[model samples]
Target: MSFEIRIARQFGERTIAAEFASKGGLTALFGPSGAGKTSVLNMVAGLLRPDTGLIAVRGTVLFDASARIDVPARQRRAGYVFQDGRLFPHMRVRDNLVYGWKLAAPVDRWMDLDEAIHFLGIGHLLDRWPRTLSGGEAQRVAIGRALLSAPRFLLMDEPLASLDRARREDIMEVIERLRDELKLPILYVSHDRDEVERLATTIVPIG
Candidate 1:
């Protein structure tokens, strides 16, 4: 599926403007810290409203300021994986993965529990708690959780930033597998050039 975004937003002293469209595969928003990568992602996720622009996925209009159409975040069906795993501390790994799955409409559900667990290699951690997972493992579970929600597309914001070199590599491999195997469109926000080079199919430079 294709994803299109052309939006602009202002944050007091800074005005962030971005415009780009990407087809299937990983699209990386590459830029420095002050650049607006995360801001653009936020707008796409329906967390922020743009001053004026349009966002669409597979020709489905998500946001159109001219038409005053802004889809709510929950209804957007866009799965978001933050830098932090954001798993429920009290739940087991399986519970965390299925949390979104349970909320998703049956018609929107794409991946099943077994498929998600296999895709992210989290089968072994199913019974474990979030607190026991390493950075890489937690991120893997987070990805699986998002996938189970049957998102139209995935939004990842610096998912590997908090990891060490080894952990980063470990997670990178999982990301690569997701890109190659799942063929799910991904909008990845990151400032690291090396990571972008290795993971992105289309590079949308920001800033």
Candidate 2:
């Protein structure tokens, strides 16, 4: 997978202009807070619209102001994993994972139930509720949920920010395994240098 983004957006007193392309692998948007890293990710995910510019993945134009083309977020096929797991408190782990999978188009469905469960190492917790899981476990389930959707790419916004040091390391290892095993291009956003150095194959500095 490849990404080419050249977009600009304004937020009150501040304006963010980002232009870059990635050939594949894990690309980390690295910078301090308020550097617009999350903003860029949001635009890429189609949650935020750019005032002007183009966003294309592999040659499919997701957005293009000049051509008046803008694909909706749900159709973009980009899986987003926020810092918080955001799992449904009312649903079991298995139900949460299958929620998006059920809605995914047949053509987009590549992962099966067992595959996603084993991939994130959450098979044993499938029957448990979200509240019963620890921070790291919740994040893993979150990642599994995104993967089950069979997304074209993954967008992670400081997924480790909410975890403790040990939990951070735990999730980091899982992310690294995902990068190597799944071969899915990931656009990871973070300000931590160590995390970037360890997980990112390419670093795009923001701000």
Candidate 3:
């Protein structure tokens, strides 16, 4: 599926505007902090209602202000990964990964849980809680969880922001593999120029 976004909104006193079409591949949102990179992503994910615009994914109208069509966030069918790996502290890795599927209404179950587990190299951490895993492990598990949701598009906001250089590189490789193997379109947010060059098929340079 593809994505097209044309939205305008206000952030504090400044107007943030963006218009772009994204084919199925990784699109990097590259810019300085506070450039409204995440804001644009939020609109596409139906997390933020735009003041005026339209958001379409594979020709499906997720938001169309003129038509008064606004699909709620949960129904957007887009997966999101935050900067901090927001895995449940007490839940085991396996439990956290399957949580998405459980919450999904009419879950597809199209993603093979076993395959996702192995792909992220988290098979060994399945029995462990989030706290026991390293930062890299947590992010990997988070990615796996998002994939298992059967999302049409994945939004990753600084997925490597808090990690050290080595850990960041490790996760980046995993992301590269996932993008190619799963054939998933990813909207990846990053301030690092190197990471953008390494992973992005198209760059949305903010600011």
Better of 1 and 2 by TM-score: 2
Return the TM-score for each candidate structure: 0.95, 0.96, 0.94
- Candidate 2 yields a Cα-based lDDT of 0.91
TM-score, cand. 2 vs. native: 0.96
Best candidate (score: TM-score): 2
Question: Taking the tens digit of each residue's C-alpha lDDT, what string does model 3 give over 18-72?
Answer: 8888887798989999889989888988888899999898789999999999999
Q: Which TM-score value belongs to model 1?
A: 0.95
Weakest 10 consecutive residues of candidate 3 by summed lDDT: 103-112
Q: Evaluate candidate 3 by giving its C-alpha RMSD to the native, one decimal.
A: 1.6
Give one digit per residue, the lDDT tens place, for model 2 in 8-109. 999999999888898888999999999999999999999999999999987789999999999999999898898888999999999999988998988889
RMSD of each: 1.3, 1.2, 1.6
- Scored by lDDT, model 3 comes in at 0.87
In model 3, the clashing pairs are none
| CA lDDT, candidate 3, residue 52 | 99
Q: Which residue pairs clash within candidate 2?
A: none
